[model samples]
Target: MTAGTVQALVVCSTASGAVTSAGGPVSCGTDAKGNPLYLSTVQAYVVDPASAGYFDAIATPFDYTQAFGFWSVAFTSVVGLYFACLGIGTVVNFLRRA
Candidate 1:
């Protein structure tokens, strides 16, 4: 979540039927017949430099224009609401004086 850091969702699988990571082989537990059980899982990790290029193609660019438009709309809404409340308050004050 920091600058220059790349996050990746990795699905661990083994062509040879043995899952592994940098530490060592990953295992869930033994089966009823005592065979080693491997579990494929979805894991999130910070991608290394070597694999960063693969993720670049899927990365989305920020849209500044759209963001600016949304900000303008929000500002306008707040200003309009303030003026509306001021006008209502002035009307109530005038009626009370009458």
Candidate 2:
């Protein structure tokens, strides 16, 4: 298959779950039960040279698994700061009325 094109591979198997012929084109032979075999697809992406730098700049240095903990900690810190500010405002209002 050409670049950026998806290609399907048809795999044939017997009734006992044994593979017969694999890696054939989309129009593959039937299985032992006279039924069509399963089809697997493969694709390749061709990126333009001009856009490669843009993609690199937007890509994250850390994977999602590592970023999850960092985001959770940041969220908790923001919530804590919000409550602290609220508490301070309440105390200031109480003193101003006294």
Best of the candidates, TM-score: 1
lDDT of 2 by residue, 1-98 (tens): 22233344333333323223464334355766687654444343666566677778888486887789899999999999999999999999999999
Per-residue alpha-carbon lDDT of candidate 1 for residues 1-98, written as tens digits (9 for 90 to 100): 33245344434344223356665667666767777666454445566677677678668698899999999999999999999999999999999999
* TM-scores of the candidates in the order shown: 0.42, 0.37
**Which parts of model 2 have CA positions greater than 4 angstroms off?**
1-62
Model 2 RMSD in angstroms: 9.1
TM-score of decoy 1: 0.42
